[model samples]
Target: MIPAAAWGYQISSYPGTGGIWLRRAAVPHTGVVMPDDTDPANGPTSGSASSEAQRRTELGAFLRLRRERTTPEDAGISRGTRRRTPGLRREEVAQLSGVGVAWYTWLEQGRRINPSVQVLDAIARTLRLDRTERDHLYRLADIPGVPLDVSATQPQPPEHQTILDALIPLPATIVTARYDVLAFNDAYAALDPGLALLPAADRNVLWHLFTAEEHLQPLVEWEREVSFMVAQLRAESGRRLGDPHWTGFIRQFSETNGRFAEIWARHEVASSVTRRKSFWTVDGDEISVIATGFAMASTPDTKMWIYTPDDARSQRLLGLLVGRYQELGPAELLRRGARTGGAGRSSAH
Candidate 1:
């Protein structure tokens, strides 16, 4: 007899009016041994099989939790007064994710079924999973080659922010593996005043370069810089294949930017290296600087990029710009500098 606690069910008897009593109990087969030819070392042990089963159960529960928290209105479905569920129903999830109701039901029931990455992506999007939650979903689905750290968008440390601030005269920024601007010094912000004023979501270097015309206009050799940046991103993509944030950014960027899509299709790849970049300032002055990157100690995946003026003239211009920023503040300086054509520069090596 199976233990009631182990099976999670109880046996009970019902008494009949005719003086007969009936007892019923359901016992599920909980064990299945592997074939004799199975390799002992490589094959799943009974313990391993049980663990996998538990993981499936947990995965189902997690899906249910996320689904229950997602309201119909959040999924763009019209809410009805007679709705009974707290959030989205199973059918609603299936419909929104473009999957069949029965298949999704089996998945939610913890039945063993292989889910493709594409299907999982659709489900994740429908659930509106954040980076961490998306990573958890991929792992629970048994996807291979998962990123070592999926929570790549976590806030930058305070010390890192302070370090950025310390690099006041020289333009500096701390960026994630995906080139998201985690922190930037005032000098860096002054270099591109428009970028500094953008929303946090649009602050990423790659996103700004590809999507914003103003970002590209200041670069001396726009095509060359864009190509190299794309190549660098392509190289990083190999290590970040299954990362939701990385993948989502690439997809959205490609869809929105025709040039990015064209460049990405070439499949070019390059490693990051110190280089000289030049920028044409609003004042029609050409400033050259050397740009270099250093890995942050607190976050290995993040790097600090500093742009130092290469020539005496460029250095003096940068110092002048910094002084103006200190005196007038970021917004006021940007306004006055633009009006006066006072500052604009680039890095060269």
Candidate 2:
């Protein structure tokens, strides 16, 4: 289903023929017919037939434009000197997408055939469509649902970084809908110093929880935490069905982590909410905390998570850790933590 935010409500209903949805408000008839109304040279007949014909014409034009803009290399095809066209040929697209050349040609011509979502997905992949382009393709092909906003992946502004830094003793980090760890404060780094050192590709919270045993060792209820995180990812996936990055991430992560694959296959989904958590410190002492997540006002697709101590003992322990980290700094703390062979190696987002 399309998210209410991504699509305008002006569309009335699907034509059920893989054609564009009909608008709720009709265009005025404006009965003044042009002199060329019946002239085959001008185009198809006018009125409702003309509207449907025009939509097909526009669909064909849209497909052509996207096709022309795409390059052979972009679709993983080797460039050849014989090719006169700017982009992929219809047969080349059909071959790459695993469809019949004639059918693909008809689709580009806006024929009456209705394409299944699976077929449209194949075509979208072949064209190297991004999230927005894929959504536009779906709409042109009369597929339902809204695309996830891509702006979520844009670099966060400096103010966001400042906000994270200001969180201070409390561990705080900003994450995208895909759970990419975009930014983190010193307190958060203190919580898991090794995380800040990890390569950007390995910074995803779920990826760490599932694949990195060292990071998982500190969590009190490992299975429960992992299951909840998987459910949250599943929920996000529903809203971004055909997105290449989202789909590719899932495929790669699943291939690396069998446990995540099993849980993901269950198709469970859950909304985000505050939860109490416990992590073991280097001294083997439990640090109970509450983790709260909130959507950012400036970027709805981004979220901020803050961890606060849940009890007096936990609070003192957190304060002590933060104070020591401030005094020693990240490098010294990491060096000491490494030599001690303690929970300092454990990391989180």
Candidate 3:
């Protein structure tokens, strides 16, 4: 699950992370996140101290304001009658959020420290933040929040499926800048049959290209197409340099595929472009396509890629492929699609 605030996901109030949340190892001690001011990357790093510093300071103040306004009764807690300050104390917020005073102090003080998504969600809930306020808090922190529940995020509209299906013979699919395949037509499924077999998370073009899935084939200009994909991904990665999910995708691919790691290390960059592309099927058949894209206005950084048959042979093949899909139907196709072990071995297993 990813942050809902940025990706149309509703804020989740899950009390636990459900899986392994932290990296490395967990320390059985309080004040686990020791403050380090020397690390330039510790706090926001936009060059403008006024802007970044102000954002962090505002974030701290915002948390403080919420804490001060909410009474102990609202938080379902009480500290006998000796309390001097109004609302819950700094220590109380930390304790309620399952964090330490020292760590939360730095967070509240706008110090250089990164808070985990779970911790932020906990804090937001403790402060009784609404969806809009949660979004604001994440924005102030310069962090894209992930919803604890996958369902917290919205799904593609029913009309999108109809739009995809209407493309008929033309192989078309909607994908994010990250090449995450959101929706596809029957022709697309026919052209790249392996796509429908994978789980939702593995429904990525990059994953399909490198994995044991037979999605990749002999191309017209050798491996230039794949190289272009890598370059394009690198170019778009600038939008989310420290994003966990984006970084994890790169890390997993780099760890698993040597060629991918090598290409990624080049730092080459490219953008999406219309071009004539050719692909060879496992059956030794070739299909040429004129690939064009249409931006989806409703979904940010998402576009529809349409592959039109460029040659007579391709046109015939595409028609045959669509017919094949129709004959098998969705139910039969799904029944035949078996799940594979994804990009890498999950840490959980």
Candidate 4:
């Protein structure tokens, strides 16, 4: 049986084997093998042969798309003659990807071949695949994908809360390594209702920036913020490439968000968690929020997000939203950030 936590799965018994294999024939990305030793002969059953076929078909589409997007110029091949297609030919791709023409053809044809990690990595690099795409490539091959360490940090010791409180009127929050909003005083919530309404699955800032339209569309500078978030997560993923949770999250989100899917295909890996970001206060106000990362005393994946308005204008606007320092306008009651933590970012495996 596949783990319940796994998504997009159904059970089917193999011909002779007592157990089942998670054969994904439709959407290759989610098709994972939940192999059972008892039944090996039933032609690799997972839900039904259709699911496996669907998966294979999707894999073919992904490979073809990758191939079509890359050009001779991208592969450093001379475009001496007029080309019949927009991108590099299959032969050029095979050459640039460092795989034999026949092998690449078989892969594009959806033939059964277990691609190695090294080869897949090379192909991803050659195709200029971003972190998400690289993760997808691995998934299509049915390789055990990277995991994410989504463990919540231990509760902040009283001293830590005191530190957060000492920050005073300044908005501050303690977050887990996965960006879980662990703890924040009223000050933090006093600034942004959206922050308080941060979705349970969006504790990770990157995931929220990429997947949550409500959280992101409101941002005055959506593209810049989302790009930076992607770069930062890409950097983090690099450090923990073998983590399954992170990999799965990347995959699920890519499948859902077209914008994220496009950007992730670029294969740009970077980290800028400490960069500055500007936010618009709810009361038609604007302010700059600079991020600073602080390590936890004892907990892993725990850090703090501090928001200091650039000036009094932003401060007043924030107060109006949270109803804490009612100066700009009447105070309004807003839900505080979730007291209990929620799930961390998804893996892209």
TM for every model, in the order presented, reads: 0.58, 0.58, 0.61, 0.47
RMSD of 2: 12.5
Residue runs of model 4 more than 4 Å from their true location after superposition: 1-159, 198-202, 211-218, 319-322, 325-349
* lDDT against the true structure, each candidate: 0.70, 0.70, 0.69, 0.59
lDDT of 2 by residue, 197-283 (tens): 677656877776666546334576678888888899899888767656678789998898788899999999999999999876544
Q: What would the per-residue lDDT of candidate 3 be over residues 79-108, giving only the tens digit for each residue?
A: 576888688888788889898655676677
Candidate 3 regions off by >4 Å?
Answer: 1-47, 57-92, 102-136, 143-155, 213-222, 281-283, 293-301, 311-316, 329-349
Worst 10 residues of 2 by lDDT: 26-35
What does candidate 4's lDDT look like per residue over 1-349, in tens digits? 7565553323333123244433333333312233222233554455665465556567778988987898778888787777776676766776776776555654665655556566676688788887567777777766654332333343447887788777856778887544556677666655544555664445555555555434222355768777766766677777656455677777887898888888878778765457666664433345666767777755544577777766677666655554442332212332122222212212211
Quick one: ranking by TM-score, best first? 3, 2, 1, 4
Best by the TM-score measure: 3
lDDT of 3 at 159: 95
Model 3: which residue pairs collide?
2-146, 2-147, 3-145, 3-146, 4-9
Native-to-model Cα distance after best TM-score fit, residue 284 in candidate 2, in Å:
2.8
Per-residue alpha-carbon lDDT of candidate 1 for residues 1-349, written as tens digits (9 for 90 to 100): 7554433211132112243321221211211221222234775456777666666677889899999999888899988899887899887897888876555655666655556666787898899997678778877867653443423255666888787888888899888777777778878776665567777655777677666545224567668988998999898887756666568878998898888899999999998899998766545466678989998765646689999999999888777766766676656765665676534434321
